[model samples]
Target: MDKYKQSLSTSTRPFSQPFCRRLMKPRINYKNISLISRFISQRGKILSRRVNKFTLKQQQLITIAIKQARILSLLPFIKFDII
Candidate 1:
């Protein structure tokens, strides 16, 4: 029960209440404002989700490979960047 309540607020106490409405105004105006940046942000999110999934798949592959051989580096052998 305590954990559930804590999860509701988390670290956002400073910007709770009235400021929350103000913070959301920019997102509400995204359709009219600088459309290019919004496109970039949406694309960036899609790219990040793909990369995270790829990294998890890589870790699973590496674990299986380690079982067969003794050599596996955690660094990316394939191209991936964190945005």
Candidate 2:
């Protein structure tokens, strides 16, 4: 039992590391299409905070940036594969 418990603990990884190690200072920019795209899914939907592992404030910033980019047509509203 002790050996099993030790092995289980050793095999498990910690969630201490965040998805974004270095966030952009101030806020995420709408004009930065590339950066905004990273937070979007292949289908053009914004990814969730859990997936990005960003704080509430960071997530809100990202959402605003994405929306602004979409409004400017810098980023696509929906991605479509060209056949």
Candidate 3:
């Protein structure tokens, strides 16, 4: 199907998401819970690189930071919704 072909083409392409050309790299800190929350799901799950569009290194850093934040009580391990 057209969708499947398009997905394959994109996967082969370099840099699926926009890459920063800056000399300095962005810092991933556990203390920045607000920013880290963007990479987490509503159920307190860390999103994958495919969904977040982050490079492998960045994704690893995010996962580590999220785990650290959770241990420190900055981020929650599980989210409970009030229905």
Candidate 4:
């Protein structure tokens, strides 16, 4: 009778008892965090490489275009005074 009253006086978990055992357990997985870091690194690499490639290409094209325009504009001004 005393044991029965002791159990009754305590506050039991919402899950009664069995499920509470699993709920109170501590479990961990490190692979998920590693995967998150890998994803961010991969994305950063892709973006930086693309930006660098485009900048180089744009600089080359602009230089070539300006040289061509200068040659075209100056061609008619040259005089071959060969007597």
Candidate 5:
């Protein structure tokens, strides 16, 4: 392989330049069920930062929001087994 091609193949990380489009932040309100669900797993668990790519503050907000939704019966505490 040519020297230039070898360098291109080894670069996996995206450029540090700010994205043209920003990622949408999730709402902390209980009524924002749609957005909240995207940050949670099908098993009714909150997803981690690595998977969700949310900032520390955002993750904390999501955790509290999901808990509130659960308490209000807006979201499930645990998903029921189909089997």
Candidate 6:
């Protein structure tokens, strides 16, 4: 039992680190299409705070930017693969 437990612990992978520690500073803008696109999924849905690792304020800003960009036709409402 002790050996099995030890083996199990050793076989487990370490927790993954986030790709970017700080994605961006404050003052997120809607005009920055490139930056805003990063926060959106391939399916055209806005990514969550947990996935983006953003604070409450930052997440809210990102959501607003995405919507604004979509309205202005700067970003697509949905991404479709033409295959």
Name the TM-score of candidate 4. Answer: 0.24
lDDT of 5 at 68: 91
- For model 1, where is the 10-residue window of minimal lDDT? 35-44
lDDT of each: 0.34, 0.80, 0.80, 0.33, 0.75, 0.80
**Global CA lDDT computed for model 3:** 0.80
* Model 4 CA deviation exceeding 4 Å by range: 1-54, 74-83
Whichever of 5 and 6 has more lDDT, that candidate is 6
Among the numbered candidates, top TM-score falls to 3
What RMSD does each model have against the real structure? 16.2, 5.5, 4.4, 30.0, 6.8, 6.4
TM-score of each: 0.21, 0.70, 0.73, 0.24, 0.65, 0.68
Stretches of model 1 off by over 4 angstroms after superposition: 2-54, 71-83
Model 4 local distance difference test score: 0.33
Tens-digit per-residue lDDT, 1-83, candidate 2:
99998998884643333535365644478988877888999899999987886777678888999999999989989999788
Error of 1 at 75 (Å): 17
Clashing pairs in 5: none
Predicted candidate 4 versus true structure: per-residue lDDT over 1-83, tens digit per residue: 99999999884733122123243222111222332122123222212323323344333433343344335552222334556
Q: How close is candidate 5 to the true structure, as a TM-score?
A: 0.65
- Candidates sorted by TM-score, descending order? 3, 2, 6, 5, 4, 1
Please give the lDDT score at residue 72 for candidate 5: 95
Q: lDDT tens string, model 3, 1-83?
A: 99998898786646464445252145578987777899899998999888877788777888999999999999889999999
lDDT of 1 by residue, 13-66 (tens): 332232234443443331332321222233232123233233443334323432
